[model samples]
Target: MARFVAGYFRSGRIPIRGVHLAVVLTFSLLAVTAHAEFPLPNHGESVIVGGDRAYPPYEFIDKDGKPAGYNVDLTKAIAEVMGIRVEFRFGSWSEMRTALQKKKIDILQGISYSEDRSRTLDFSPPHTIVHHAIFARRETRPVRTLEELRGKKVIVFRDGIMHERLKRMGFDRELILTPTPAEALRLLASGKYDYAVVAMLPGMYLIRELHLSNLVPVAKAVVSEQYCYGVLKGNRELLSRFSEGLAILIKTGQYKEIYNKWLGVNEPPRVTKELAIKYGAAILVPLLVILAVTVLWSRTLHKRVEARTAELAQEVAERNRALEELRRHQDKLIQADKMASLGTLVSGVAHEINNPNGLLLLDIPILKRVHDDADEIFEDRFREHGDFMLGGVPYSEMRAEIPRILQEMQDGAQRIKRIVNDLKDFARRDDAGQKELIDVNAAVQTALRLIDPTIRSSTQHFAATYAEGLPPVLGNAQRIEQVVVNLVLNACQALPGVDRGVSLATGFDREQNVVVIQVRDEGVGIAGEHLPQLMDPFFTTKRDTGGTGLGLSVSAGIVKEHGGTLRFESAPETGTTVTLSLPVPAQRG
Candidate 1:
């Protein structure tokens, strides 16, 4: 009874056996034709089909190098029903469609249904149903009212039903048509389109595929459409067979099973065109308002970022300028310090020479008197009464007067020469003198010996305390001399104008194996506040008196370069002590 009812529906009649045998025969023949399970028509062994390879979830090549998707599955089913092994050729959809019309392929599958499509090919009953929906960014609000979309742009697939619907609603001016559903969705996610009419199922598939949460369905579905497999228009026999096979699949519930497998569950409240229009307006109006607010916020943030960047640049520039100015001032102060030290050295040298030279002048008159007496005796030549004169003459006449005068003159000249040699030794400057091992005590003694003139002129005395068995230190001898000279001169300068002056001391701190030299002076003490800045370049209390301010600074640099330390102690109105600590030579080894 069920088969009869299916036959009646399929053939457009009630099955009455006696009255329409020819009709039953014809219906039966069509039924048999639909089930004709042959390898191919008598002329060929296979069927050819055309498809677009890039279209995913419909007609595409899978990673395993096999054709896969809903269309591939549907084509296989139809081939099974037709009892033919099929081959596929791929190209652009337009090109494929043209090839199909040229009778180059036996069938084309998974094509969206349209009135214009009917002009080119005959279509089987629809295999899948889909709708056109607007996709937009999640930040966008639902477009619910058409009147609110006055200035917004929307995108649609080319030759889509959306174009016709939007034109009818006077929104054609705002429509932007795209070639692919994927492209439209991308633009929608980026906020380029206020609304995009794209394939509803494909859009949903991508949303899940990409795990995209920032996009939303902005407009309601505006139209529902169906997809069908097609054949060229002249292929009536192939179309007839396809229709019959489709009816059998439907009657046997196989079509529903295939649909359910690819598409999943049939959702309740299927979206309609009315719902789409209603929601499109519902979504778009609020979206436009939100977009306006977002644009304003972005502009405000950009301005703040630019402002902060400019402020940072300005601060950096100011800091660089300050550092450069400080460097220049330091260089100037160093030059001034060298000149000041040179002047002090000149005065010390003059005083040192004066002592020896003055002693020689004092001895000169005695030598001249002795020489005159000896010359007078030699001129007389013992001419008068030698024997009688010799008896009466004193032993002083018998003495070797010339030899004694010559001996005294030689001694004075040697003393002067020794002082001059010491000055020369101290003044020798090897311009390329780099770091060398040196006796710390010797360097200190040389500095003081050269400065002895200053000590005498100041009416001051210097005392030294030496450490027994102190080790040599690694350092440049000339540089160490310069440091000692700077310290001793600074001590002299620190002293008040008085008979009592400064003391030079040297020792080793046994536990540290370090050589230490100290200069102590009875002078007006340094103020507490200035002590910390004593070694700072260009920082001086005696600028008004032409103080260069770099004596301590240069001393500090030399000491630091030798891996040593310089320290000092001072009391208000009392005195000051400056100390240097240099590492022992044995430790450096």
Candidate 2:
């Protein structure tokens, strides 16, 4: 290397540094020239191309009635990069082959290369190889070679290359023909023929598509052929353009994509030691140069990067805080949308429940009368026949029980009716009546009755008590009742199972000059974080089962309107207690 530099100076040539600059300039120029050279074009009319209509993963018309398949995509890609204008035509395979012979089409997109056809067509280098196979029913004895197919009734695609080959091999007399490879395979799978001859790829493709599980490739790759694009012999200009475009596709990675899209399942490119070393060195040398340049570049900008990073850190913190606030607002908005029909839902509930309770209220009285009238007959039967059964209970034991059962049913129905009436009053859009002295006990009792079914279904242990002489609260009675009903209903819903107990109690808080109603439940309670949002609109834990968090929000609104305070106390899995405090009249307090 030193001698070469010295010799260059002696010969009055450029300096070593100048030579290095020249080399870089030369490479840069070459890269620009290569980029400019595309897209290669035949500056004439569009090249008319033809292909077989039935061949798939290569060429065919798709179900959408478009000219499609692997060959179509590859041909389009080739045309794009090569700057070629092209038009496609598809028809029967034999018709296309004859079209090429008679100069009806300029090129065939793909054809299996054969020495006999080479005289009439110039073939591009093979893009793919097709191995023909003999397929038979799975139960058939495996035939390993093509020669073994003699004298057997073999199904072959009519006018296909396989048909011509079989004719030459003297099996023409025994051949059963179909128009397409798929049709041939179907015929073979129907058990009508001894075997089917088709390209291995199309055979496999069709078998899966037709779900012909009984078919198997008995003889593998009996013959393989180079699949290539073909044009009339000696049309070197058009043929050469295609050949170069195909080579360019392979050199770049576009060919790999198209190949993998269709044929990668059958054949993945095998990696060899030589290929690994060649590509590894090609990739590594450029990376090493980049690394050295990056190190030098970073050293010069280190101070600026550090300054910018500090600014970015502060900005990120501000952004994070803003994002958290925005997310909370967004959650409320989304939840509001989900609960849009809450008013309608509550009104519908009240109406539906009112109907059933009305039936109970009317029927229970008649049932009680019927039982009373039948009591004497039942007693006489007992007297005559010693303790016979009555309603699955022995008459002796049932004598006292029937009346009690009737009374309890009557009481339950009446309570349900009262509750439904209160629910309806709350559900009325314009039922905000004037404030008055509300009996906390009476309001709570009516509310509890309203949710009797929910309470019964939720917990077996439930009880309520009213203080004998608690001062009345100054509020709209219906509005106050709605709040109590919502609170108790929520308490009932919070209980995990029937075993959990819920209790309600009313008392006068003499020190605070308030009347208080408290509802408590042994339930899976609210978490500390959630307690803060209990009265926020659209914040229910039961959203999955249609809980419109608005229940508590609406309840809170009523309490606020009546000059009362709503408070919650709870811990997860321990239980929750909700307290309602309403201001008592000054004289009463």
Candidate 3:
């Protein structure tokens, strides 16, 4: 029967009539069904078939706790054709592969054929073709090809064929490996990832079972792989038998039935003139009746539309007025929010400056008194040396102390000046619209100086490391400083004690053509629940400590405006590292 069917297919002699095709299929099925009692191979009476239980619709544990799916059924059918008993073992993909290598499992179903695997194993003729698809949010633009996904945050099953394929295609940098496609799709739906590369059938099954409505297949399959049963390299007889059984299954239309049951089949509709005419006649009277009624209703609808149009115009005008009012309120709210944030920063700066101001105030009067007394002594000239010792100190000691006092006052004044300058730079709104080529190392230093007071107030050790020969970044210096200040301030706040340390580092990312600034803190770290919302506007973990939650959000915005990315990696008890990556302008040299 298998030989006859193969001959027919090879002859390209498909029956043109539906009845003839049905008869041929029925005979082929019967012939293959009779061969179900064929003798098993001498070496093994029962074969062990292994598959990944996580792969749905192909091989997975059903609700009945029994191994089930298309591959399971297909393997069973093939085993029956070869008159062999089958024992199914289910595990992870890697575990199953190891089992196959160890000879614990005689065959592995639902495995994609690869040249590397062919070295140690013999693959049966492919029973089915698996197509890989890119799944992403429905709102995202469709990514039809692999090239379109360059640098996209993609998720794929770890060690799966798609993962290897992506790595081979030079997308290893962007992949976020997951243990299964379901997890990958879930992450994609949650916006943690930009795309998921997975087999279409299993991906669709998971989306339906999990009810992930936000995601959809981006486009047609980006890759198609042949799935076949694998046997040990020396098991030539078993490989041959499995191939023959699979061919018989196909010839008898059993394979097609299984394929359709699991992954839906798309059949073209047969449109004959007679059938179309018959169906057309059946609806022709109703169509004419509806048309006549529609003509009459059109006149009434036109009158109603005129009235409705006038009403809609009035409603639109009211809506416009409401929208304008809303916009005014929004603007006011935004301004208020900005002012509140600015007020908080100003308060911190004021507290920092107050200490220096107080020192200057106390020392200025004492220094002036000493100077006056010394002038009087000098004018007398004939006065004894004791006269110059107004503060009970020798004249030489007084002269040295006076210079030291003036220097202290000057340093204090300079400290105040630097604070005010940093404040002025931070508060400049015009910096957002301006771009300039500035040294990133200088920016980091300035930010460190501004935040040094905050860092010193805590017992946290602070350190800065700047890489030599770093290229300048194209951005507003003040804006970059703002980002660094926010990150450092957040790091300081996260530290629970003086034993922890915060480090700021700057270097060039030569491959990506960007300047990287990293702020790492050995602090309490962020909670997992808060990581997703870490950059959300008004989302704060330090609300009790006067945190506006706008620090990270505003910082992220500033970085983005400068064509850069702000990312954070944090784990509880492991501390956090926030990285600011800003693109470097093209070098003239």
Candidate 4:
């Protein structure tokens, strides 16, 4: 018999090892002697066992929809040995508990031990032990203990031992009770809950059955629960019968057979120190040889890795130097772009200043003439009868002419002030990069004023249309002004002669919820081929005219940065219209 048992173990059919075989053999001998004269209970009818209908592997409806599983199989084996027939009643766990409590069912299988339940139910000796574990998304850190689940969204089966345990542990604030462990795990897999508390075997089984790839069991078991059958309190006879039958099943090896069939082979029993010592020398001899060989191999590999790491470090340094040189070249290009924009504005500014300066020069000669006339009048008054007309003209006429010349000079100075203010605003540095609610119409008007001189010199008719009650746009005011100025300057340059016209308009695009600014010019229009490349950096149709090609490109970039668009529409000899559509600020009550 000893030789046969050793052969059975070595075949790997049973996972048991070491001292466990002795325990099983001892119990088997006791079971034969104890069963010799054991009396069977006399129940008038079939024993009715109650279990959850949906729970799998333990108790559930099978493919043919009949009640089945480990608990069912165990119950049938116990009944067969006790010389009685058994029936199964499948329902919700709550219903099963109610039926068992009301004496409607003689047995309740797959129930965990609980203090409250002991008051109304008599539990049999535990048939199986289940370890409770935390189930969470695979990407989440493993929750090794119950305390780690605190402050996280935890789902548990309603009325289950896990729910009661969490409540006792003061985790009620984070607990979400579901109808079943399957439901709780489903919620956890869907990311609706952070973790689920459930038995390890059932959770793993359900995860595979449901094909929930995201859910995984944490490595550490939180608690272990003994699952047993229950009967009504004071039904000591039925509970005693169940215990004896279960003992018979275990002693006969039927319990282990059923467990292996449903849950897979049990892990090998722990090795004893005597068993370890018996095999110690066999294991240690090869391990020492491997260790010595590994040490020599590791030394060689370490030197190779050191050499490779040094090569990688040198390569990294070279790449960084190349990147630094590229950055410096890019900075030069940006500076050149800025100088080009400044050069384009300088000509328009000079023309604007010249007009005001000319008016100031004209006022100088008028002042001189007024002085000469006043001097003549005073001389004539002194020479002739003390009230003589000045240079054969009336003093009233001289006074009127003096006031008119002074008013003209004042007007000219005001015009010069406006032109200088516009230029300063355009040239102001916007380093802060702050954005605020801006009036698009106001920005359009400022651009028109700044570019007025260039427009007059390049085109005959210039018109501006402003829409009232337009919605405000959120952007950097200075940047928006720059975009408008670039567009208008481009339009002025596009005009072929003074007969061409330019128009600037501002309005709200209600459908798109944006503020629209349009600058149209009747000039030598752009060709279709050039239109696509108009916004490309360093691309321009006016290259021969000293265009640096950054105006449209830079303007388009600015518009995009402000969450807006700069689009163009043009036909040969017809006109070119550049439209800017900027998002409006969300209204606040």
Local distance difference test values of all predictions, in order = 0.63, 0.73, 0.71, 0.70
Residue pairs in steric clash, candidate 2? none
**Candidate 2, poorest ten consecutive residues by summed lDDT:** 1-10
For residue 84, give model 3's deviation from the true position in Å: 0.7
Q: Candidate 1, 536: how far from true, in Å?
A: 99
Q: Write the per-residue lDDT of candidate 4 for residues 1-589, one digit (tens) a residue.
A: 2223333333433322222343344334333333313233356677788988867778788889898888999888888898777788998777887787677888787887766667676566566656677888988988677877778999988767788878977898999987777788888888897889887777877888889989987743466555777776656565566666777787798877887788653222334545556665564465456545555555565556556556666879766565556545654555444544553454356466667567776776677678777766665666675432232223433434454546656675665554444444433343327888888888888777887788778878988899999988888887888888888888889888888888888888888998899889998898988888888766888867657666676676678778898889997888899989999878789
TM-score: the better of candidates 1 and 4: 4
Tens-digit lDDT string for candidate 2 (527-554): 9999999987657789776475667877
What are the runs in model 3 whose C-alpha is more than 4 Å off?
Answer: 1-45, 265-589
Whole-model lDDT, model 2: 0.73
Q: Which sections of candidate 2 miss by over 4 Å?
A: 1-44, 267-589
Candidate numbers, best lDDT first, in rank order = 2, 3, 4, 1
What are the TM-scores, per candidate, against the unseen true structure? 0.36, 0.39, 0.40, 0.40
C-alpha lDDT of candidate 1 relative to the true structure: 0.63
Top model number, lDDT? 2
What tens digits encode model 3's per-residue C-alpha lDDT throughout 247-321? 677778887787778754421234454566777476456545654565555556555655665666677876655
Residue 133 Cα positional deviation in candidate 2, in Å, after optimal superposition: 1.2
Q: Give the TM-score of candidate 2.
A: 0.39
